[model samples]
Target: MVHLIKTQSSSAKSRMGPASLNPDLPAVAGLGSFEKLNGFFNAIYDGPTEDPPWHSALNLLCETLHAKHVTLILKPPSPVSTGILVNTDAVAHDATEAYQNHFFTLDPFVGLPEGQVVTPEELVGDKVWKQSTLYREYLKPLDVKFLIGADIQTADGIECRFRVSRGGDIPFSADDIALCRLLLPHMRRALQLHSRLDGLETERQLFAGAVNSMQLGTISLAHNGAVIDLNPEARRILAEKDGIQISNNVLCTDNRREGHELQRLIKEALSGSAGKKGPGLVEALALTRPSGRSSLGILVKEIPPSPWTVNRQRAAAVIFIRDPEASVAETSQKIVQQLFGLTRIEAAMALSLANGSTIEETAENLGLKKNTARTYLRFIFNKTGVTRQTMLVRKLLGSVASLG
Candidate 1:
């Protein structure tokens, strides 16, 4: 017959103090109990923004509960998935590795009723638990004598497991369970916030990567025309100090006439009066480079103010700059070649022409005769279904080659 540890029911346990179960547990440090709780709650709320989210809160919980290990299974392990696991510093690397690799399936303490805290002995009879493979081979060797755990289910369908382990005879007290129960709701909310923030950050990185891959210079400006943010390509272009540069934290051109025009366009975009055509109008200009390279193409467009940000000096305008002299990425060239099934020479010629180079210039660059370049260009036109050089440039620019 299985022997079970007769513990008090949930109602009776809620009334007991921490000293009732474990009198040797350490006392709080200099701060009062209220202050410590306040700090823990703060850490919990601050977790989503932290680099390694919840590290501080988990460590504090381990200390507060006097637990040998505090493990948070953000995602539970399954037959097909290894899942996500986080542990406090008290957990050794080998113990964690072993549990994740082989013993997770055998753990009988998991899948506890959502938000209901229970010790292993309470969940499974003491005699049955001691005889189990997980107990004898995993917990016993690690000196884990007692454990308290609960499963947290978020509204977004995330199942999280919170576990606290103790090595000695002292089991978790009723006060410890009460504290965990109180914090469970907050933990659920924090995890939901973290999931949403993580998704947004991932999407931002994806779009930023696509823009950077295209070598497109993007500059975000505040309502007052101050430079708020810029992608890597914009930073590179400004760093060269060629035609466009940032002066007084605002975008400006080196040429006096072009500089005034650029400033006017930015002002128009910010003031919702592009040439008095009203808001949402786009303006374009070309800045002549001092280096005698091809002029830099610029487009300015107004950013509509959101309902909640009507009064804020947020990003009011965006400037898109493109350098005609910039060559397409080598990977993009390969993609273009594959997409059109063009010969290597033909593909190189197409990319050169797309970059605003003339057929004669491309011929000279590729060591091919002007007639041969024209022949290759004709072949490209036929294969790509474009009749004109301008059409071919539009086709290549609109293709997925830029995403390469």
Candidate 2:
């Protein structure tokens, strides 16, 4: 049988024990008087950077409140989506799946007044709550008797649910409610931080993926000419030890003259001497490969220092290495075709010109007459809005097609 009782007011007048003295109550499981509060706050702020994100904080809350389960609904479930949920390990996978799959819509305990903590018995009469299908079918099966929840609405338009549940006859105490109320604001702020950081991380990954797709080797260098970071392509290039290599964590070439020129360009870039008219101070050189292949094209650009940064030893420059011998991947052709609405032959001609093939050479390579090739080139120029071959080449190289 369901043990139904009216919940007491969470208001200050009815609250008792140490919680009445201070809203932030001390831990009961041998924690120093203030250690639990300190630990919870730390976990709240550090939640955004954690691997599972907010797992530690939720676990601590479950333990401190002496509840069977604590859950943070980062994203609430809807008819179309399962949404994101973070909870303590006390909830079994099958139970969680059942709630998400079926019981979520049947839940009557949702839509609590914003930032107000309340129990089902407090929100609805004890008899109504006990007779509800969510209680008799779901909560009863799980052996859950008491539940307290609060809804948090963030400035970013996120509506999160904070829920705690326990079994047996003991209901949630006023202290538990007070502690949850105290921590709600901190939870909102931490969620905001997590949202912002998550967006920035997603953007970073997108740009990094685009660069990698183009097979562009990017290297970040410190102000002292030491290599600080390298993308996958850069690592592969350096690993080959072809035209350029790393020596003592510094980019260098085996050829003495080329190495001297490389260092000079890096120094000029660092000192803001590489012509500062554009977004980044820029200079370029070609390093001779010992394998008798095409020389590797290198561009050294100064990274503008952040306004808040005063240190010079940080990442101050970036180098871009492009190997002319590397054939354009086939995805680039598809992108060019879709971008300009070009036929296969027209797209091929455009990419050939972009890669430095002469009109006659492309015509012979593709087994087309010179006049026919010129006609196709004209169609490409019309479709892409470029007048001349050089313009077409520049347009193609600088377009999103390169991102493919």
The candidate maximizing TM-score is: 2
Span of 10 residues, lowest total lDDT, candidate 2: 1-10
- TM-score for predicted model 1 compared with the true structure: 0.76
lDDT of 2 by residue, 5-63 (tens): 23434663233434334434422332334555778889999999987789899899888
Which residues of candidate 2, in runs, are more than 4 Å off? 1-32, 213-215, 222-228, 246-252, 260-281, 302-305, 309-316, 329-335, 352-378, 385-391
Could you tell me the lDDT of residue 91 within candidate 1? 86
Candidate 1 RMSD to the correct structure: 6.1
Error of 2 at 220 (Å): 2.8
**Pairs that collide, model 2:** none
For model 1, what is the C-alpha lDDT against the true structure? Answer: 0.81
TM-score, per-candidate, Cα-based: 0.76, 0.78
- Scored by CA lDDT, what does every candidate get? 0.81, 0.83
Each model's number of backbone clashes? Answer: 0, 0
The positional error of residue 390 in candidate 2, measured at the CA in angstroms, is 4.5
